[model samples]
Target: MALLLQLFFAHKVTALSILADMYKKRLIEDKEVVIASIVGMFPMGVRVVVLLLAPVAISVLGLKLGIIYVLLEVLSKFMVALIGVFLDRKYLAGGVLEYITNVSLKNSMLDAFKQFFKVLSILVPSIFLAMLLIDLSFNSLVSQISIETAHLLIVVTGTTSTIAGLGVAGSLIATNEVDGKSALLLLMIASALHRIVESLRFSMPVNISLFGSFGVRLTLILLLMNELASIFAILGLFLIINFGFV
Candidate 1:
């Protein structure tokens, strides 16, 4: 396993290096390209870790439910990636620049946004996958989660990821000339405030049926059914291999 992991990491590093060169050739113009490259690899590392722990994550769903969870995980990641791409184009490049400039954000803030999007393209999927598992753990109807809380989670998680991504990007942008601690502190503060806001939102919908109770329960059933189908798919894959049908 260790050797396999090392080999997997080696490929990731090689890929990162290749991507760095590609950026250097096309987009990256600063001296901080190397730092950007290193930080850029963080999401790759995160994905690898998640895959390695797939068994544990699956355990929560049971073998049957687990397989379904994996598919949902994949679907969620795909959805997030699609959204990230749109975000990257619409906001990361243009909006981020405008937002930073108007707010008088320091240089690191600018660099961070560039880096954050690069990583977010990868991180969003992981987040999406994690959320499905979270739903499974909670087992409540999707509607049971208040709209305020739901929106809050989306905002908090999105903002926090954005800040962290930007910090890494900024560190690379500065090539260590800027203090890492200071940049990190700023990121933390931004994310912390977002969290506080989310907590406040969590309490705003008491005694209010955010969605109809019937719709909420129906959505849960559909989700459960989808999960079961995934388990059968995994079983079919295993059976195919056992029968040498491939």
Candidate 2:
């Protein structure tokens, strides 16, 4: 049963990848609708299937292989989610053109879906990579390191991702035809707004839901190259944990 389940999930991953690659370059009549369906269906499907089979695989493969498999699964989904978000947002929100014309950042319904994909893309892979790298470093310097090392790695990865994201945001705004300074100012304002929303979540129920929804929605779209960094992180972590730096 365990073997069968693993095989099933592996096959599902393959099929989903094929579909994503197929639609990668194609433009559809309804970009948002198609992108939403793809985003909603693919990662969730992979997540559910993997979660179900993971325990069984873990028992069979031991901690090392088990973690590796999970890392790969998380990273792959993250990449797909990132790409899906961009594709969806571009289609639904009309990309840079609409954003500048409207001067409003509130994403539409379809945009929400894209956002979720973008956040997930970043969160899943980042978390996995952090886990992997800490494990590796710990093993390499097994005598010198402590358990706190793992937690420290998490902090580092999160901070790095945030800083990198800010850089990307600034670059995007600067490149816009609108006044570069103005674009940067608008983006900074938006970031401040998002921060307020994040803070208010603790005391305000409505704001909590709003930011939570926003966070989830935003995951649907992230830069493609960031996804690769996440993959490397996961691989590095797994190597450290599994092999030890002997």
Candidate 3:
């Protein structure tokens, strides 16, 4: 829910900026840009709504039904995009669909392949190093630290190396007999905020500041999940999974 809200507002803001830029550069008329932004942001807004409803849907209906709803929502967005592209053809001087079908598809595929290799190169080595560290008695070192200190270390490791951090946390959870509440808190922080390094790597190629992405994600994680309330929320989820509601 939090992630969806964040992404939803981000997309709307980005669409507004894009429209302003387009109008300023005379790339499109004001009316056309308004329509285009609305069309583009519709899916993002719907995603927020769908995610907000997911918990209730899953609880009442079932996981399978909830997943089906998400898939249908996504497919509906795709249909809307297709329809918008076709409808806007006249406004775009008639070749937009063809260009998107051929040139854009090729470029997107090439970029996706490049990104896959790039991410794989980083992730594989990180995972190996994480495994190596665990075998070297790193967990023993962490066991000696105070619980608060351990949590801090986990968060730091997560920010630096995602795989290593997860490995360390898993080891601690399994062997240390850590408190369930604390373990859940640490897991939430590590999993959600651990992508700081990956975000930096991707941001650089897109001409975005690494710190900007890192700061935003970190802030959001802390704000949303770093509290007693969040711990209770996790407890609720744990209960739901283990016992279900009567």
Shift of residue 150 alpha carbon in model 1, Å: 23
Flag regions of model 2 displaced more than 4 Å.
Answer: 1-29, 49-51, 94-246
Lowest-scoring 10 consecutive residues by lDDT in candidate 2? 95-104
lDDT tens string, model 3, 164-226?
444444444545534434544454456445434443464233322222343354333323322
What would the per-residue lDDT of candidate 2 be over residues 111-184, giving only the tens digit for each residue? 44564466557655654554455446654563465634433332333244432223333233333323332322
TM-score of 1: 0.24
Better of 2 and 3 by lDDT: 3
On lDDT, who's better, 1 or 2? 2
Quick one: ranking by lDDT, best first? 3, 2, 1
Relative to the true structure, candidate 2 reaches a TM of: 0.28
C-alpha TM-scores of all predictions: 0.24, 0.28, 0.39
What is residue 82's positional error in candidate 2, in angstroms?
0.8
Residue 204, model 1: lDDT of: 21
